[model samples]
Target: MSTFGDFFKVTTYGESHCRSVGCIVDGVPPGMELTEEDIQPQMTRRRPGQSALTTPRNEMDTVEIQSGTEFGITLGTPIAMVVRNKDQRPKDYGNSTMDMYPRPSHADWTYLEKYGVKASSGGGRSSARETIGRVAASAIAEKYLKLSHGIEIVAWTSSVGGIHMFPPTATHPTPSTNPAFLSLIDTITREKVDEFVPVRCPDQAASDRMAEEIAAFRDKSDSIGGTVTCVIRNVPSGLGEPCFDKIEAMLAHAMLSIPASKGFEIGSGFGGCEVPGSIHNDPFILAPEVPPLETGATRNGIPRPRLTTKTNNSGGIQGGITNGAHIYFKVGFKPPATIGQAQNTATYDGDASGTLEAKGRHDPCVVPRAVPIVEAMAALVVVDALMAQQSRQVSRSMLPPLKTNKPEIKAMVEDGP
Candidate 1:
């Protein structure tokens, strides 16, 4: 279950308190330039102790490439990467209340029920530490996507607790209906998102408020939950499998797989249900001219679609496939369950009953650190879908063109950028 993807397979290893945690990334295109440096930035961003808002676990999170590359060039084999687990404190959860009673809402109980044994420290594989492999694998996928298709995946904290960067109103009940929100998605970058560290909200005022909210909860030994909004620009159309593996469906599967992720929704998402069909429908228009590909880069050569949607109420995907429009979505993470607050609960034996004050270093609000994780997962979904679509296109290209009398069908077949 630690593995993900088909063409680009990734199998993660290790645990929260284990010796090391990493992944084996397969399906990287050979001869591509790669190194540990290409993957470290994201690891550092997702590492703990970046700011007071995050956990105090001072992990350097230095990554090392064990194999799959020869002098910074991928050898067309599985890439093995690892990051040692330093500063782990297994004693923090030993010979204490955690031995009997599981932390309320934490994975402590369910993991024991599932495996009949639990890790000595933390949630083991269920911890956010598990996402390190995902981030690492996705870094490679992101690099390939950027170099090949000019794809850009960026995510930022959009809401913390009740404070929203773009609050819904009577006139603009959802971000899809708000021009300002659309503009932000069109131009926001990871650099701009990181400018407001600790909160990562793009808006200065909203970021400040969110930091304060998190501090208030941390002061009281409590925690808060929020949402991260991510946008993927320049993704080619025709990505995603129909019927079963719809683009949105695969995206939901990927997003929800991350630890603490409780909800996933694409553009207009639940809000679209409130609008009537006339207003919700995305009208088609001829796509404008696209700029030339970047000079001297390995290009995928996937042509841009001839048509695009006037309104993106469908979130860049219609009928389960990408429409060559910017694909955007939001992921909701639940509050970290490892709060310091004491709670009454039954023990493992279901007999002892008492307050168990959990002890551990945890984030007051995870949305800040969760930004890269969301983007990483989004990149994985896009890359996997792109590979699948590309394979199908290549296989079909070998056959003769369909000889049809219908002008409409012929026009559709010949349409291209």
Candidate 2:
């Protein structure tokens, strides 16, 4: 189903070349302040035609709030938002017969097999443009999460094609913003769009190489793909459900739903599989000074030194639940199949076919633009989990206070001054 979430359900509709694409977000709390402006920035980030690296199709992508808000405040009804497709190139798509001949490595063949039909122009529902509604709804979710909890999500293109970035370490520096969308061109002089025009790598030398590679491929009419890494921090524990609704499972479901995403791994993903169990396990450590027992702490005031496997072979997920650690994951994207180069294929009539060359603007690499999309999707998953957790513990009286009686603390105290 296109809809997701247990408590905070969201249903998205529309297509890439349709009149508009939008989403209806249900289960939002009443009285939360929301506006079109809040979502515009994220939409703009995902909008094509922003730079030379992306499709030249320019879209205003302006959001229209159709319902669920009164005077800029949510009324506890479903929130409806739409983004009009201002710059559509229906004519640019050429002939329908050509469309009937599926593009190589795309969902064209599979979609037709399952549905008996598909959008003639563009990939239709499979297009990246379909993500506009998701980004918009996610913007609202992010705002809510920020207001309620201090959680943050970020993603960056860690590698592209043959170039790879060194992992961040304690000794090495960390970027203020994730490197995913940051300008890749590193030079003493300020760069205009052209200067930062290659693959989005900050390292000047590597960026130069990447740019050369992209230019070479573009000239030859080919495409490439890479990887994106996302990090979610400050997420409170106990936000995920056990059994079917586990946090990682929910996140995997959402992330895999993105178009062109081929793989998903959290924490010490595939790499962990190579390590022995003894080397991969995280060892828990007890806190030296637990908060004063009177300060309303759990019996184990010092949380167990979590399943601190020395190395993160399991990717920070244990028993399908979050264990109060930073969650990290990577997604692998396949090369864009809409390359300009010609490929051999059969025509619709099954006649002896010739080569077909793709015509139209497309990214030589899509990993850069995917960074924001990944972050937006991650935010949606985390916020939904947070809301679900909050819903289950509806009674404040059920939780112990932050402070307790002095006598109770003394009674539980161990031998020591």
Best of the candidates, lDDT? 1
lDDT values, one for every candidate: 0.89, 0.70
For 146-258, candidate 1 gives per-residue lDDT tens digits of: 99899999999999999999887777677898899889989999999989997999899999999999999999999999999999999988798999899999999999999
Once all C-alphas are superposed, what RMSD does model 2 give against the true structure? Answer: 6.5
Residue 75 of model 2, lDDT score: 92
Candidate 2 is scored at a TM of 0.81
| lDDT of candidate 1 at residue 366, scale 0 to 100 | 91
lDDT of 2 by residue, 1-417 (tens): 778766677888887678899999998888999999888977877778766666778888999999999999989899999988888876656675466477777776778888988877778788888888888888888888778766666666666677666444333223212243222211111122224433544456666666666666667778778777776765666667789877888788888888888888776566555556665577765434433332133344442232233333444567877655567788888777889877898765565465667666677777777877887888888888877766665554365543435768646643221
Per the 3 Å backbone cut-off, how many clashing residue pairs does candidate 2 have?
Answer: 16
Instruction: Supply every candidate's count of residue pairs whose N, Cα or C atoms clash at under 3 angstroms.
Output: 0, 16
